[model samples]
Target chain A: MTERAIPWPMMALAVVGFAYMLLPIFVVVLAGLTAGEFLTFPPEGLSLRWVAAFLQSEKYLSAFFFSFRLALMTMVVATILGTAAALFLARSNVVGKAALRAFFLSPVVLPGVVVGFALFAFFIYSGMGLSRTIWGLWIGHILYSTPYVIGTVGAALAAYDDSLEEAARSLGASPWRAFRKVTLPNISQGIQAGSIFAFIVSFGQFEVSLFLSAPNAEPLPIAMYNSLRYQFDPSAAAAGIFAITLVIASVLLTNRLVNIRRLLGRQQGQ
Target chain B: MTEATAARATGARLAAPALSRARLTWLLVVPLLVFLTVFFVIPVGLLFATSLNPQTIGQVTVTSDLTLDNYLRFFSRSNYLLATGRSVALGAIVAAVTLVVAYPMAFVIAKTAHPGRNTALLILVLAAMQLDMVIRLYGMMVILGDEGLVNQMLRGIGLIGAESSVQLMYNFLGVVLGLVQFALPFMILTLVGVIRGIDPSLEEAARSLGASRRRAFFRVTLPMSLPGILSGSLLVFALSISSYIVPALMGGFRVGVLPIHIFQQVAEGARFQFGATIAVILFLLSAGAVAIYLRVGARASGGRA
Candidate 1:
């Protein structure tokens, strides 16, 4: 038998790939601050003008507000629905559980464009009048994000012990109280993780938003898409910077509460 | 003592009634069903119906003269077929490249004892979430454009002649780069889970059996992790094949993928039925690939059990 050593080649590949993943995102932040009106690489001069521009403009500011509101609504709706689904699948000796689970999680596989098309047509035909409204965007974002919540909460439920709930019940607690005290706290991490994911997905959703977006209710991503299509300007880059900052803040917030690895692990559970 | 015993008996007799499980399940699942049905199921059905409907250009009719013309045109047209083929080809390559890049990274993360590994992984996760399709595409444009980052860097180094620009943007290379960047995270994360789950003793046992390190990984670790490879690759492939934003933004007018064509037909041309047909085809391709992936993944894991 030969002695083993560190695989330097693998390590090198990992570092290079990590750099590749991070490089473009890193560049956007730098490019945003460039004093030039047009995007200049290596940032000829750094200034906060673009950020200021983003702050001052009614369009970008309103879009940012709209996106934030949409994301919050999505997070709340998805979490509640996902929590209910997860509870059923976890606690009940329900028949057709596998099929139901798959059905609920189907959004994960459906292409965003297809989902966008489906919702757009449905909104139009059903006479929902949701097209371009905050709620329409809310529904679209929720459909896109709910699967993550289900996945996360399901993972938490899988890892939880049933006896804990039984014990709570034995202590004169009602079924609802048992869940509130015994189950919710244990699964809160999963819910929080799922919440973060839902927020991000909703925040960055483009395909669904593209179909249903109106000027008044354009999400930041949709706004960026619209801007990029008609023109190339630093405002778009500035918006990109703003999004990146939000992502960083969210990630840091998640990290502060729970391990990111655990969150990711919960997300990928089959 | 007799009174207490009688009280305990009475308490036992007066038990809390169980919640009707059927009612509970219904309450939990009904909202989900309604939401998915309205937003997902019915919409897809509508899309299919709309695509099948027949409509003449410039006529606004709710009822379509049902026909297969749209599907036929998509299949018969050389340009559409070529674009579809290009998309599949590029998607396959991107999937493969992503695996090549991701496996090593996953391996390193799974094997390393570094303190910074967690931070690195976290940063990667956040970065993965941060790069929206539009921003990433725009960033690539700045880098791959005529006076973009790469060209500017090259110019600064005096490697190439001044004022002689390198034309890399609006091509297959630029598009693939953006797609790969977007898709790599899922691959890496999926593969990382697989790598971490592989029994450490198996690799040690292979090493003890006189297998070379690389041979050990290939023969012992890799085969065990085949499920991850299949799932991750399938995800990347499915995603890239149906991708709209990257191709539409970065691929430019020259490099037309199927989704871009679909977008153009519906959004730009108002050929709703024609676009739906293309969308259906794209959807089928994605569905077929996913079904195959799931079957393979099931076999890989199910056979193990």
Candidate 2:
């Protein structure tokens, strides 16, 4: 390869661009770790005092737990619904397949705030008593998260060869059994990845949570936004540290199980 | 290549189960279809319908009567007119800036060749992307806030007095910066795919024909990657225009974009009709952009998309 050495100019530009992307994160982590009371320049040295405070703080803890609980619920439902849809999209000769795929993915394509507000208005108008309730919030999270699961699982199904399942069926395996034994194992990685994404996206979601969160129970993103808006809180940065940890842990876990780069290709215009 | 892929697709379709398997699989999609119709389609569709209703605070149901009053008010009001212009400008600006900064990184990643390094870079981008928006904005606050690193450094270098630090954030500029930061990973990822897909032999052929490296890049590589640029920019535009958190946090409630207007009108004011009108305009704007993106993308990929 004649291009052994990347031109110094281009490399320098890369460094600058990377630094630009990374600088704010670095600042936040350091601020989260600061020993000082206020979020200050130089971070005034590193410590875990704020993180400890964050863990002990009642309001923040409750929000954290609520977020965790909501995300777990979102994960379970989204995984099931999304995986089933992915199978249908991949294997079935459905009418207007392209249009159906687009319809399924539209939740992701639409802005989160739009989805949130529309649902909020709907619940209020329809008068099924879902307004500003935990059930309403649950519905919002499911709507937002199911698309990500569909995307990941759909990608997985596309990559898998369906012939193996067909072969199993020809050898006298039932339709469900062929899927259970042959197709399921092959695409389980996608299911796992999809569920993890569901958990993570639901946890970090702010826009939808802003409109749909029930009274007296705020999601962590909403809580953090209020904290930042009204006052400066190191505990907020500490909360950030925890969110980053969740993202990193799940990403590494997914990477260990599957080629995340290939999944990333699904995020084309996302 | 197109013919081969088309044939493979048709073959795969032919190979699928030919019996009541179709009925069974269609059953799988029923839940999602019903779920989306109830929560997604009907809600969003109702919102569009509500936008046509005249301004009515605390009105839950769409009225039988319809008028253009809400739309006219939005069009007539200078405050709203300015907000719409500002939102579009912010999106356009963020898309341009993110593209320029992300291109170099995408080019480097696409050409790295080493699998380990490429994987590492990809993972890094994915992690940054997955990082929660609230947390990521917290980072932005630390650097762009008053007494932040930039202002502190500026003061240290005597660019400004301690009492007169530059307002780096809590304005339109801050929102732009936050959005660009948010959009960088997306732009980079979109470009790397297209850039890597471009045949190296074409560039090599240009180089062998007495062209410089820069000339080869400009003539062959850059033109080929145009699709990625347009796609990424369009995506970024839709994202920035519809974004609520960035402006809310970065602008400190001062930057009044369409989203902020909608939130204030509906969530806070309980003014459903006016809020729905704002949401409709926003939905249309982004939908137009996405419609263009899908069309352009399909043409670029020879209708494979």
Candidate 3:
């Protein structure tokens, strides 16, 4: 700990700031658990009725599971591609390296809505038969999710010790084997954290799915959006409860697998 | 061996391996490069082309009769022009407010040297960021709605009549508040790094030299952390302007920002050319902000950032 006292006024300001950040979240969770018919805060009384309703509702349940499947698919592909790109970036002395890195991460810098619309329009023109299909949505998701994997894994690669892999190579192990043995183990935690993040991001992705989602099979966020628009129901809050649960679970899981602080400390800050 | 002979020999050996390594690494990145080009760049490029086309519904590709009708329409229409302005205004407001709300939090987090307390603080920030925007904003609905928590509290405290309820959500103010809430974590995280990187002794030196604590912070530490403040606000600006969900939900479709306009035109109205027009404008705006961010970031880092 530092020797400084961190003035009380600053601490008080911080507490208020934190309360502002947390107020909405606290309200949502409590409202979801409320026994009342409509969403309300300071719960009229606590129960699992909304959760049960969410689980049983065909429309919400299907969308939730569909989102789960989509996230799974997005995570797998983004991990492989993003990890490969990050590794290449770290190891290669390619020309215009900075430009290339910028290009790879550019999809995320644009609004997700733009990316979704562009892809939706592209699919319509290309005659690829992917428009409004799950394939188009998946592609959009991959574009959105891969940069995060790159960010996290790139942080891991930056922190990794290179000499250990060099030592393995010097001991006559094959280059691939040396990488698998020394380097993979070291950065595997990063890959795991990144992939999990990809899952979380894709699962919660709302903007991109807004344009690309299939009419018949709306993703969870879009479903909730529609529900919230047309009807005010606690089940939407219940849906939020699950989304928040996934977010919390992913954070805890990532913290366990890697020093999340180090990842944030890096410039990538995915 | 003599120095000259050894140098020549090593150069020959190193050159071969160096060339091969570059080739190998380029090969490794090719797949991802191809994937993004196919799926990302081309699509956006097509959208730009579509925006240039004449007002033709269901036309997703460029045509020979390319005209700037969509652009002209956007420029000519008061609502669209006003939306463009509103989008910029909202982004700037959100960025400024986020800076104010987040700076103290970042300061506290950065100065808290205790590992457990710091970790807890960091976790709260990260968790809030990771929580789904839709889910988190649902909480906003609960808090900021007419009958929401804030209004209910005000009524309980007799600040207003029992019959009155202030309209917070479904308006510009709600969008600004939601954007600020969404942006706080990012601004805090960015500033925390810079603030922590600042040397404590600099402030101590000011204090030792007879400056008040506040004076030292304002004169020394605050100036030093300007890079973070600038970049974080720029980041927040990009996020807020480009955001679709926050404005859509919190504004309840009543706030016609650029993003909301794009969604209404393209997704709901099927006006692809018009949507693409608004999108291109939005893209240029965000791109301008990002370009500034890159410049400021480079200067801040004293190199690549």
Candidate 4:
């Protein structure tokens, strides 16, 4: 209730912390504008040549499109399945509901490296062909991204009053109609937020895609990884700027649709 | 109505239709359950199975015969053990550093009276979380490289000779810096939520009792946010240890950690068995941390269940 005086040390520490978080991103964007061929802090000359070059390259362009398509597919599938699961769990009196919730969220705890390896081995053992590796990557992305959707939608549903649905059912409305008209409209923001999160996650996913990607169908991260590994250039910084832009755009969009703080602050009960 | 009459009425109303409603609810979750069973649960099971299977040298195939050869080899090899040790140490250090740096920022964001500043800070943290890991690592490389930003600034300031710069990249320090930056946003956001939940009255009450600001914070605020600290540290440690891109790109293969080691074992050597073993180890380590955090959280909540 009282206006507390901010300590000088705390203020200094907070500034330094923000600088630490933002400096790398600012440096990368700055380097991408360099006219010089190599990555550097202060630009020899400012130009968007590297960004143009990366955008024009056929390999990078295709990787960009591939990542886009995969992310779109992942977003659609994860949203539907995760929303359905959340609806059931949130509305029903299911036995072992806590256990089921934990199971759905287990991927959040599972290390990405392990998930990559496990899914890679599973695909191999199942005799999946190279052509189907994209599908394999999609499945992997869905598994990883679905938990975010479920979490958001479940949080939204927790705040929802289920009696509205019951009232609709008590009337002439069918269960599906009641949900379609009442429930879906109420949680649309959460769904949109979750979809954005899912899309961003799938777009930037690296660990699982690193293993599951076929030789010719590399995602953007895998392509960037390969390029960085084999050759160091300012073009990678250009590509990084693009990635950062996409993330910023998505986060801002999510913030517009739903309160980003509420989405991220979700803990067990609160 | 009496409690017994109300309960009996509810029971009578629900007995006939409960089975059908339960069936519909079960049906709704069936798709997810089946999908996870095939995609997640089975694959992890197969990964465990593969870890147990032994591989013959120069052979692309692994034998189904059960053996601990993979685990034995991992333990016996000094390089592998060293990598695991370094990973644990690095994870701990990153978690600790991020916690220290993020606590004040979180406190300011949660407790500040200025709404606009808090919103801006929250957005920054969220944006940072969504940034791609590979891009962030690349950014760190540019900042920490020999002829990079830090050295460039230092040299221009006349603190160091033009011919000399600090060795910041292609080493352990670069990897640590990248991982800490990568994990800090998550820690801050988590701590913000926890810190906000603490009643401001409690801290004010402590202050009213003649406690200094520092003492109030140390005694009340810090102790109250222990759950957040535990969960955030565990999350950061697990992420830091499991990270591959930061170590591989920033460390320039100079730092060998468990994830990178497992990657090499599989990618370079085509030793799937060894990769699986390392994966299993990493999985258990992270899962163990989660288990411990859960136990502590349950106890902290005074065993609610």
Which predicted model would earn the best TM-score?
3
Candidates in order, TM-scores: namely 0.91, 0.95, 0.96, 0.94
* Candidates 2 and 4 compared by TM-score, better number: 2
Of the two candidates 3 and 4, the one with more favorable TM-score, higher being better, is: 3
- Give the docking tier of candidate 3: medium
* TM-score: model 3 vs. ground truth: 0.96
lDDT of 1 by residue, B1-305 (tens): 99999998867744533344346656887788898887788788888877777744533223656888777888899988998899899889999988988888777766654547665675665666555777777777777877788898888899888888787767898778878888888888887777777888898999888988899989999998888898899989998987788877777766888788877876788777777788888888888777776667656556545
Residue A32 local lDDT, model 2: 80
Model 2 per-residue lDDT tens digits across residues B1-305: 99999999867765675656878988899999999999988999999889998887788698878899999999999999999999999999999999999988998888888878888888888788878788888888878888778888898889999887788899988999999988998899989888877888898899889998888888998998999999989989988999999999999889999999999998788899989899999998988888787777767777334
Q: Tell me the alpha-carbon RMSD of every candidate.
A: 3.7, 4.3, 2.0, 2.5
* Model 2 regions lying over 4 Å from their true place: A266-270, B1-17, B303-305
**How high is the DockQ of candidate 1?**
0.52
Candidate 4 chain B minimal-lDDT segment of 10 residues: B55-64
lDDT by residue for model 4 (A25-50), tens: 88788877888887554568889998
Error of 1 at A81 (Å): 0.9
- Which of candidates 1 and 4 reaches a greater lDDT? 4
True contacts kept of 2: 0.67
Question: Model 2 — interface RMS deviation?
Answer: 2.0
Candidate 3 structure quality by residue, lDDT tens digits, B145-264? 888888888898899888899999899999999999999999999999889888899999999999998899899999998888999988889888999999888998899999999988
Off by over 4 Å in 3: A1-3, A39-42, A268-270, B2-15, B303-305
